[model samples]
Target: MSLSSFKREFARHYNDTPANYIKTKRLEKAAELLLISDERIKDIAFNCGYNDLANFTKSFRERYSCTPSDFRER
Candidate 1:
């Protein structure tokens, strides 16, 4: 299938754009790691496929309304 066709079908079934769905899943994994692991936030972000610490912080905050460290502390 074409990229656009796949994106449309993916969004139709998932109710999220492909990029957002992937990003959300990544953030969810990060949140789980924050709660369950002793790994540092930057490492968790990297493990979750984030290349930039600042971008990870911004995305995590947007999804969870808190930084990764704050989420872990909560």
Candidate 2:
């Protein structure tokens, strides 16, 4: 399926907008990087399409309720 059609179908089934779906994927990738890589926070932020560490941190905290450092510690 085309990306637009897939997005529509996904939203119809899961009630998630394309932006949210993309964000969810990015967050999942971020979690993997946190667990598996020794990359810096700035590198992770840029890789995940976040230009600013503060913005990344804010979104990460909002979704997970913990700082990235804290999340990594656990």
Note each model's CA RMSD in angstroms: 0.5, 2.7
Q: What tens digits encode model 2's per-residue C-alpha lDDT throughout 1-74?
A: 89999889989988998899888888778878988888887799799999889988998998889988888888
Candidate 1: worst-modelled 10 consecutive residues by lDDT: 62-71
Model 2 residue 32 lDDT score: 81
- In terms of lDDT, the poorest run of 10 residues in model 2 is 23-32
User: Residue 23 deviation, candidate 2, in Å?
Assistant: 0.8
TM-scores for all candidates: the values are 0.97, 0.82
How far does residue 52 in candidate 2 sit from its true spot (Å)? 1.3
Q: Tell me how many clashing residue pairs each candidate has.
A: 0, 0
Candidate 1 Cα deviation (angstroms), residue 36: 0.4
Indicate which candidate wins on lDDT. 1
RMSD of 2: 2.7
lDDT by residue for model 1 (1-74), tens: 99999999999999999999999999999999999999999999999999999999999999899988889999
lDDT of each: 0.95, 0.87
